[model samples]
Target: MTRLMDQEQENLWDSVQILSQINAEKAKAVFKVTIEKSLQQLGITVPVFSTIRLSVPSTDRLSQLRQIEKKMREAYAHQEKEKAYEYLVDYIERLSQMTEDDPLVVRKKLLASLLNERYKRKPKWSAKRYRLSASLSPLLSKQVAAAYYTTSEVAKKLGLSDQTIRRMCEKGKFPGAYKTDGGHWRIPRKIFITTPEQDERAEEALQQIDIKNQKAGYVDEFDL
Candidate 1:
């Protein structure tokens, strides 16, 4: 509320503040009656007032409520100032409309009319950030696999560095592991092996060939 030169104007500002401060529905109704009498005396229209309750729990909620209240107060003050601006514009428009000669005045009034246009609502960080933190915490700190090995454990078992294992999984070289809420990684036991079987098979094949050649071929000339 602001100081006014006239006692009637002071009463009107007081009525507005008083009406908005009433928390209970019944009290607000009585305040509105008082405001009506003030309005009749001042010959001015009163703005509608809405009460908002903070429902969240905890100390954080207290800070959030205070911040919201501060912003709401500023918004109300802005609205009141805008009303004064609109009154001046209305006065000018009335004068311009009487003359019906100034196109620039008409354009200015049209632009001024849009000054109090609806503000776009912004997303609240309290709920959004809290939910997002919950959602992502599971992803980052989960445990998932047969060996109860985290992805890091699987990497260590495979003789690959942790960074290399991550790169391999990202490149689709190895299957992904599951993650649990407790931040453990579990890899499928099938992907890990004792050694490459192909090398063992090649060694057996070479021994078989050497035995066959020794049996079929004649002895060396020196041995004969």
Candidate 2:
């Protein structure tokens, strides 16, 4: 990627030098004058400006900008709330420094509106993704958050039965668990840490599970 970028820059530099030389030669060959004067010198009657502003979006630049917009919207659609928020904030913040003639100026406003609306919804997201989604403010990433795991996965890691984890979550033991609309428990990876008292509670819970399972003619999943 670095090499490709360098090669592209080198080509652009070379092209710029060649074009600059050609333009310099042309400027020396033809003295600059008002368009009216030049037309008068050529015995023409049409009036024209001495300079004209050319505004066009290059193919690569346009494609890159569109790709960014696509990713931003996709993140939102996929429910990656944190990533979507960051993308929205970045694009909207960049809008002010951009010239009005920039190709994406209109898109900036459009995306800003769309993102701000979506951000205001404030979807219940995981720890790493708890963001201030309502504005184009600096991203405040949570200090310790990585990923979301299912209840089953968390149970396996903690050496507890799936039923035990689900029951605990349902009983409000794991407050960090977020249930989706479809009745699925999505637990944050950071929620497993226990206080000393909580650890004692967990031990007692497992012992109770052992007793209950033994009486029910089943095996408890306690590692001890």
* Per-candidate RMSD, Å: 36.8, 29.9
Supply the TM-score for candidate 1: 0.20
Task: Please give the lDDT score for candidate 2.
Answer: 0.40
Writing each residue's lDDT as its tens digit, candidate 1 over 1-224 gives 12221343333233323223322332233223332322222222221111111111223432342233334334434676455444434433432332223646554543443342222243444322222224565654342222334566645343336765555445544333443445433444433322123223323433433464477553231121
| TM-score per candidate | 0.20, 0.23
Summarize candidate 2's per-residue lDDT along 1-224 as a digit string, tens digits: 22342343333333223223334322111111111121221112211111211222234533443355455555665788678657655644432233234535544544544445334453566532442233324433222213455777655444446886677678755445556544667665433322223334434444444465576643323222
Which residue pairs in candidate 2 have backbone atoms (N, alpha carbon, C) closer than 3 angstroms, thus clashing? none
At residue 174, give the lDDT of candidate 1: 38
Worst 10 residues of 2 by lDDT: 27-36
Candidate 1 at 154: error in angstroms? Answer: 2.4
